[model samples]
Target chain A: MLAESLALSAVLFVIGVVGVLIRRNAIIIFMCVELMLNAVNLTFVAFSRVYGATGQVFVVFVMTVAAAEAAVGLAIIIAIFRHRQTVNLQNINLMKG
Target chain B: MQPYYSLYYTFPFYLFGVIAIASALAFVTRKSPVTAALWLVNTMFSLSVLFVLLDAQFIGVMQVLVYAGAIMVVFLFVIMLLNLGHPSEIADQRGRWPTLVAAAIGILMIAEIMVIARGKVASRFQVPPDFAAEQMQQYGAIGTVARPLFNEYLLAFELTSVLLLVAIAGAVVLGRRKDTRAG
Candidate 1:
């Protein structure tokens, strides 16, 4: 049963990764990153069932960090949009090497 | 008979699991950011159900309150601030290579997980019989989680608060208007 849950988490994480790699919209990529974080949180909680409450505690920290990332990331996206007038990844290439 | 009660108990896990995966797929595929955000909320709600099923009730409630309520609202606010209409125009403009690579990576990950699940890698983490029920009775759900967060993990908890503060300040600084003269 736990393995099944872990497998589900892995599949979700993979979907999130695919979303991040393929999607060009900055906001969509951010959302996909959130999806990946949630998948990891699911894994932590599933493992917490076996190892006791430590995994759940770690999940709390993960969620806190995710919240912080979302805040700062969205702000960066807005800043870029302000300067470039577009959130498309291809166009926002001022730092291109 | 293979214990009919176990089937009843495990059904919701599978149900919520399917809901979460489906909603997550919807979230990533939607053309409009607003629509995608809504689907992501559905995914969060389903994951919260899964957390409760795992006997982590406090985390389940926090999942809904923080992820679905607070974080998603922030996402929607940013989406609106950007005023991105007609997402179809900007959606998936990067040709076929990214799609092909993403699919290949996803398939490889699923295969790896299947191998792990089918092997001894998953067996090492087995829960002792009655451990979950005993823990629930001894500490209750919230108390068990709170003990570690406030005790062994206290330093990390405090650091998260500091990180949140820094993120807030950085967001304000980055998002403030540089000048009102041009408008």
Candidate 2:
């Protein structure tokens, strides 16, 4: 069952990676990144159960990091949207060398 | 074999698997940001069930509380606030070579990990002899989880609090009203 959960987590993470790579939409990409974080959370909890309590403790930290990430990422997204009027990644190339 | 065996075991097995895969696909395929957000919620719900099955009861509850509850609500709020334009038709995903290469690498890496996981699973599925409640206590009960959580791991926990504070500060800084005259 642990193995099954880990596999599911990995598959979800892979889907997220693919979505991030293939999609041009910034919002979708952010969602994919969240999916990836969720996958890591799944692994932590799974290991915590199978091995010990440390993984769960780590998961608490991971959740904190994830929440912080979401706040910062969304604020940047909003700022960019205000400037460009669109969230399309390709069009926002002001800093491109 | 007991009549409830399949009900207790196999049902969640297939249900979580299907929900995880289906929601993930829907998340990637949907054009509407709200639709994508909804599917992501489904994925989080399914993963929470997966956590329960793994025996980390506390973590399972937090998975629902934190991921499914707090973070996702924020995601939905942003989606509504942004009022994003229609997702561009997933244009033919040009430059196929790089995608193909990445997918192939992913498949190979997953296969390698699967081979390693198989051995661990085989050992885990075997049942151990039943023990009395006293014996279970000797090995430590759920209290063991909290002991370290509040003690040994307290610093990490405090750091997380600091991390959240910084995040709040950053958000405020980013959104602060700029003095237009300075520019």
lDDT of 2 by residue, B1-183 (tens): 222335677688679878988999898878777788889989988887776666566666777888778887887777667776355533424267757775776677577767766763466554432322232255454564576778998887788888899999998777554675266
lDDT tens readout by residue for model 1, A1-97: 6777799899889989988988889998999999999999999988787678888999999989999999999999998999999889988898886
Candidate 2 chain B: worst-modelled 10 consecutive residues by lDDT: B127-136
Stretches of candidate 2 off by over 4 Å are: B1-7, B88-102, B115-142, B177-183
- Check candidate 2 and list the clashing pairs: none
Interface RMSD of each: 1.4, 3.6
The lDDT, on a scale of 0 to 1, for candidate 2 is 0.74
For model 1 chain B, where is the 10-residue window of minimal lDDT?
A: B1-10
Two-chain complex of model 2, DockQ on C-alpha atoms against the true structure: 0.50
lDDT at residue B67 of model 2 (Cα atoms): 79
Q: Reference contacts recovered by each candidate, as fractions?
A: 0.74, 0.50
Regions of candidate 1 where Cα sits further than 4 Å from its true position: B1-5, B119-127, B180-183
